[model samples]
Target: MLIIATYDVCTTTAAGRKRLRRVAKVCESIGQRVQHSVFECTVTDMQFEELERKLLAEIDQTKDNLRFYRITEPVDLRVKQYGCFRAIDFNAPLIV
Candidate 1:
């Protein structure tokens, strides 16, 4: 499945800043970042669950927001992009 992950982490406190970095690090390991706080990930059901769990842990329920948009169709068939950030094709090879 194609999953779009976006997060808003509080930066007003030291702990909040730490959580922000942790969330970004976890997402970066399993997905491609398209925006500063949004990511495009291609993951299996189990992978998705684990990713969700990891992300949920880094956020304070009352002070942060995290969204996961599950795209049911093929990614390229549904996504739109503009400017310098290239659109992501999950089925294609991603050279790091």
Candidate 2:
């Protein structure tokens, strides 16, 4: 499944900044960043569970906002994109 993870971490404090970096690191390990605070992750059910757990641990519920969106299959039909930033096609064969 494809998971879209987005986060808004309060950066008014040093701790908040640190949490933001930690959150980004976790997402980067499993997915490609689509925007400054948005990531596109392709993972299995088990991986999603673990990812969610890690994210939940890094965020402060009182100060941060986190979300996960599961994109149904036939993703091309569900997601539309424009501009120069083209997302990688996970199903395509790797040339390098």
Candidate 3:
């Protein structure tokens, strides 16, 4: 299934900054970064479970937030970019 994952980790302290980087890295491993804190991931059931576990371990329950929206229905995603908005096609074949 396709998942839209987003997170916000407090960066006011050193620990928070570290947590933010860790969280981002986890997401990056399973998905592509659409924004600084947003990612689009296509994961299986087992992979999704592991992703959640890793993210939970890196976040502060009281200070950080994470959200995952499962995209089950088809919807239109349009962009109106003036510059530097290089959108990635998650469904396209990756050319190395």
Candidate 4:
């Protein structure tokens, strides 16, 4: 499945800033960043669970906001793109 992860971590304090970086790192490990605070991840059920768990550990519930959007199959019908920032097609053949 395709997961869209978005986060907003308070950066008013040193610890909050650290949490922000940690959260970004967790998302970066499993997905492609489409925006400064948004990521597109293609992961299995188990992987999704683990990813959520790890993110939960890094964020301070009192200060940060995190969200996940599950994009179902037939993604082409669900997502529309514009401009120059093209998203990677996970199903495409690898060239490297």
Candidate 5:
């Protein structure tokens, strides 16, 4: 499967960049980075899980906080529409 992982640093500090570089190295070994914080990975289900585990561990080793979004598809219709609008679509419309 093809996976897209996007991560954002909470702050633009030296520690943050260091952490990002570590994570980027791990991703680079497994796949290619197509954007500043986004990686395009071709992995099997098991590989994907392992990658997630490694990323979490790497994040824990850093002082900076981080957020990530992982999706199996490149084109997520819902995200394409609502992500730009800062709108979310939950089963309950009120959640948005």
Candidate 6:
């Protein structure tokens, strides 16, 4: 399955991107940040749960927020139509 995660730093700061990177890494090769703070992950239900937990752990409720949408398959096409991410292969190595 695929999950589209969109997030924002309510109070922008250098720490925001750092925290976001930490969270993004937890998803392993299944996740990638398409925009500054938004991410997309493709994984099984179990992996997705792990990713969500990791993201929540890194977030500062006082300073950051996220929204997630899940879809099974065809995630690349969906992203292309929305003009957000270029078609991405989630199986690729982590960009970090």
In order, the Cα lDDT scores of the candidates are 0.92, 0.97, 0.86, 0.96, 0.64, 0.70
Q: Model 5 reaches what TM-score against the true structure?
A: 0.59
How badly does each model clash, as a count of residue pairs? 0, 0, 0, 0, 0, 0
Give model 1's TM-score versus the native structure. 0.89
Ordering by TM-score? 2, 4, 1, 3, 6, 5
lDDT per residue for candidate 6 within 1-96, as digits (tens), equals: 778877665446788878767656654356776666566777778987877787788888788887788875565456454565475664688797
Judged by lDDT relative to the true structure, which candidate is superior, 1 or 2?
Answer: 2
Give the residue spans of candidate 2 off by over 4 A.
none
Per-residue lDDT of candidate 1, residues 64-92 (tens digit): 99999999875567887879878556677
Assess candidate 4 and give its lDDT.
Answer: 0.96
Taking the tens digit of each residue's C-alpha lDDT, what string does model 4 give over 1-96? Answer: 999999999999999999999999999999999999999999999999999999999999998999999999899999998988999998899998
The estimated TM-scores of all candidates read 0.89, 0.97, 0.82, 0.96, 0.59, 0.64
Candidate 2, residues 31-69: lDDT per residue as tens digits?
Answer: 999999999999999999999999999999999999999
Q: Which one is best on lDDT?
A: 2
TM-score of 4: 0.96
RMSD of candidate 3 to the true fold? 2.7
Q: Model 3, 1-96: lDDT tens per residue?
A: 878899999999999999998998899999988788988888899999999999999999899999999877452443233567665777789999
Any idea what lDDT model 1 has?
0.92
